[model samples]
Target: MKTTKRLDLAIQKLYTAFHNNTLNPECCKQCAVGNILDHTDAWKHLSDNHGSTTLNYIGMVNQKFGKTFNGYSPLELLHIEAQFLKACGYQLPLHHNNKKPKNPTDKEVLFLGLSAVVQFLCKLDNMPDVMDCNQLFQFQPQIKTSKALMLS
Candidate 1:
């Protein structure tokens, strides 16, 4: 299957699970295919605290595709999502710290992340860049983290 199609299917599965309250760790493992958590605390928090099913799915996707998911906290996942989004040409509104805000509410962050992934895939396919924020959007982009940030 095409990568985009696969991503869409995964997202749909996640949403179905969430709406049905079937987002337990076991369910996630079966549906998300590389989710790291053994239980549904992350999903629970995502539902109760964050508002976007898309963000929850992004977390699941990162666990599956990004090797960093094993020991990551939820906040870390948000940061990774932000970095991923920025790489795809979304000019993230900077927080007061001149960085993307930490631990964004799921509603505030999920669509941006999903859009980023779509954008990245478009870049991979050599499509014309559609994002309007950064010049880097025109090229094959990489997520960049400073050494200090990485060490923190």
Candidate 2:
């Protein structure tokens, strides 16, 4: 399947971050969108809160001007972060008292987060999810199954 340059780069960076133990849901510079933007925290300025999808004044202005960071609009970045955090077991808005993963760097946790982010990225580009394996289960058998054989 074909993929946009930006999406491919984002996926690569995210995979690297996850493997390097640099992916963190609580850290702006290490979050999903942050990693996609090359580990920059500048995207944080686009939103008032860590896990919020609402754009602040600066974010709104940038969106109005049709600006993009690594091929993602300000709103898209926010949504990506929110989705990552949620999949990593973080509560929205990311309050100190809110629920979060016991170990944010756990491979299992980060994998889930990355999976969600990758799926969202695919959705943005109108592509089938890269993390989806349901198709693998849809393979047709070379020989048809007989009802009688099944009963036996």
Best candidate according to lDDT: 2
Q: Per-residue lDDT for 1-152 in model 1, tens only?
A: 23444334434544554455443221223222222233333443322222222346545655557533344444443443344445323344332434442543243343454445445434544553344345544454566689856887
Alpha-carbon lDDT of model 2: 0.91
**Using Cα atoms with residue i matched to residue i, what is each candidate's TM-score against the true structure?**
0.27, 0.89
Residue lDDT tens for model 2, 1-152 = 88989889999999899889888888889999889998899999998899999999999999999999999999999999999999999998999999999998899999999999999999999988888876557654455469856887
Question: Which ten-residue region of model 2 has the weakest summed lDDT?
Answer: 135-144
Model 1: colliding residue pairs = none
lDDT of 2 at 72: 94
How far residue 117's Cα lies from its native spot in candidate 1, in Å, is: 1.8
Cα-based lDDT at residue 63, candidate 2: 95
Cα distance off (Å), candidate 2, residue 57: 0.6
